[model samples]
Target: MNWPVFFTRLGSAIVFAIIMMFGLLYSHPMAIIGLALLIQFLCIREFMALVAKIFPEAYFPSWLTMLTQVAGVVVLLSVPLLAIIPGFFVVSFILPVLILLVTILQKKTALTAGFTALAALLYISIPMACLITLRGGAGSFHFAIPLALILMIWMNDTMAYIVGSFIGRTPFSPISPKKTWEGTAGGALLTIAGAAVWGYFSPLQQYHMSDWMVLAFCAAVAGTAGDLLESKLKRMAGIKDSGNIMPGHGGALDRFDSLLVTLPFAFCYAAFFMVHT
Candidate 1:
């Protein structure tokens, strides 16, 4: 085993656990927003680095880009001040367009600018907004849903690695060479088991076992898709990792890829079931 990688992963997990504790205890909207902002900024930086590698001549000032992206987040997160639905639309859709227009006028590479801005908006901000929405709502169970999603993803990833190492006969995708069909099945089974265990302990016992099972399955599938999508991007950029910020993990994007994809679905599930109930 690689000690360096092991220690790095341990440290990262500690920090994540601490932050999640804070979010759970405080239920402070701003704290969740702050964490989301930090993630968005880091993800955007990693994406910009990749874009720069692809389009060396592109002149996207990092600080300015960061500021705009963060501002957009602030605007989006303040949805209750106006109407959340419209605010979601503007921040998730319109802000990216406006940023792209500015980048185009600045004579940056259209393709790079467009992709970077759009990715920043969609990949980072949208899911984060879902988290914020979850945190703001009633019931501690809402928060548990996100936590459950994270746990399921971790379970899936761990099972996939363990199973893939031995019985992995079929590649899930060339983009993610290490992923396999056997691994995926093993991971899904493990995730379902984990979800059942979690549901047993959860304070909210209103949800049936079937509901928990479906949620776990959806989270596992979405998380895998998210991981594969990022792998594809990194492969296209000819980069080994998205960024060096996270020690064992490649970057914020690498670490939170599953969360990014799963959060939206989690939010929808919670809204439709838990919130309504």
Candidate 2:
């Protein structure tokens, strides 16, 4: 363990936590939405850069990437924007078509390249949309739920690294050579246990113990999958760290990759099954 490096990362992480709390826990919903949109922009940009690097032969153009970014933001915010702009939803609905149309006009393997842009747009946008949506609806959106989700993800990620570092023996996957089965299992167990405790004592009446446990499972298991997915992309792109936005964390994608996949599952569960408070 390199003590100096660990301290640097720890310092950076603390700073990150403070900023995130302010962004996510702001008094106004619009403030939170604004922060999320900013994140979406950074994440999508990184995703595009990775795709471009990985598929140099795909003929991906700059204009299309920008278009996808716009579409992604518009789509993610469409629900909230609906109340404000009224026309926002229509723009969100049509942007994808426009993106595809622009792609097809390139006339040579355009569809394949277009797929990359579309993939990036959907992959980043929907989860973020779910996050803001989590704080919405007439009592359906629970503030505590999103906070819990973020906490669990951070816990799972931190514990995974610690457990993997100390006793990880079996390689979990080839894509992320550093990860191990022992670490993954250990991290998940801790995260689930921690969530269960949190649920039992959580002041928020909306979500029950069961809900917290399920969400923890989502963060641990699904979040791990998300990390692996990003790792796979990085491997394909032949890079280390997606981008250097944070001192310790690689990029917006690196920090929130777990949240992206976890959001959909959490959203589905919250939207359909959980009894709203």
Candidate 3:
């Protein structure tokens, strides 16, 4: 292992964690929204850059796609779900139509290009919307939900890496060969234990130990899938890292891939239980 690279990565992660804690834990509730939006923007940009590099022939309008993503986020954040649902339907189709029109006007015939923009909507925008919704859903002055969700994701990923490095023998998947079942299981167990411990000390006690364990389970599984999905995308793109945004961590997408998928599932679990019970 490259000690220098490892230290660089570790240092960067520590700085990021401090910033994230301050943003989510210390700042106002609206800071979560701002942070989420900022994350969404960076992730979308990185993803778009990856797609463009991988599929140069694919005629995707980056500016328009970014605009559409921002528009979707705004609608979801500002409007009620009832109104947003119908608006999303119209907004969804409009992008593809615009893509087609742009292709025609440019004299390029790439119908599949539109799908890239749509994929961005599903992959990045929707999950981010879910995160924002989850943050604001459980009533006012409750930023802890999002904070806990992030902490669980970070812990799961960190533990999996540590456990996998030390004792992981069985390869987990072809996409992420470094991952091991042993590591995955160990990480998950630790995450559940951590969640239970958190519940014991947490003043809010929004969830019981059982509930926290369940949520941790959901986060671990979904976070792994999310990590693999990005790996697959990167493999297809023939790239080692998504971008050089982070020295050892690769890019924004690389770091948050797990959280991207984990958030929606965690949000659903939180919404169903916390809102109703």
Candidate 4:
């Protein structure tokens, strides 16, 4: 292991963790929503860049990128404001309708812009909005759910790397060749175990050990899939990292890929749990 690279990654991760903690655990709901919006923009930017690289022949106008980002931000904000404000419901529909109209107006790059924006909306924007919804809105915001999700993903990733480095031999997938079956298994097991420990000791009495374990299972398995999905995109684009925003960690998308996919699955389960219980 290159010590310099490792230290760089560690340094960045510390900063990232601090930011995440502040964003998720902040007293106000807007903090996480703001952080989520920033993440949405960055992820969409990197994803669009990747798509551009993947399909060089396609014409990608800069305005569409801006529109997509704006749309995502508005949509995210609309979630918390929907109940509080009267017009927020209409605000959500306006942007999507505008997106369609804009795409229709572009005769040459219509499909390209439409689909790309659509994908970014679905891939980045919607997941983040789900995150906010999962966290609860302005009036009823609580951070534990999203915070635990992130912590479990971090734990799974860290343990997987350590375990894979020491004893991994079997390749986990072609998309991310560095990953190994041993590492993957170890990560999942440890994530579940860690969740169990948290559930056992956590003062948050709302959830039990089984709940934590299941959520951790979602994070580990879905996080792995998220990483591979990004890796596959990079491989197809013939690139190593998504962007250089975070030294040694690629980009925002690279960092939050797990959360994007994990949110939907975790949210579904959490929603079900809340409804059933």
If scored against the real structure, what TM-score would every candidate get? 0.85, 0.91, 0.83, 0.90
* lDDT of model number 3: 0.73
TM-score of 4: 0.90
Better of 1 and 4 by lDDT: 4
Cα TM-score of candidate 1: 0.85
- Native-to-model Cα distance after best TM-score fit, residue 121 in candidate 2, in Å: 1.7
Error of 4 at 187 (Å): 0.8
**Model 3, total clashes:** 0
Q: After superposition, how far is residue 220 of candidate 1 from its true place, in Å?
A: 0.9
The whole-model C-alpha lDDT of candidate 1 against the native structure comes to 0.73
- Which 10-residue window in model 1 sums to the lowest lDDT? 78-87
TM-score of 3: 0.83
Candidate 4 local accuracy as lDDT? 0.84
Residue-wise C-alpha lDDT for candidate 2, range 48-112, written one tens digit per residue? 88988887877777687788888888888887777778888888768888788789788686776
Off by over 4 Å in 4: 1-7, 138-141, 275-277
Candidate 2 structure lDDT? 0.84
lDDT of 4 by residue, 1-277 (tens): 8999999999998998888888887868778787898799889999988988888877777788888888888777777787789798688778877786778677775667678887888888878987888777533324677888998999999999999999999999988889999999999999999999999998877777888898899999999999899889998999988998899988988889898999888877877774322
TM-score of 2: 0.91
| Model 3, span 62-121: residue lDDT tens | 465566565556534542343536565465456555655664465363444555655666
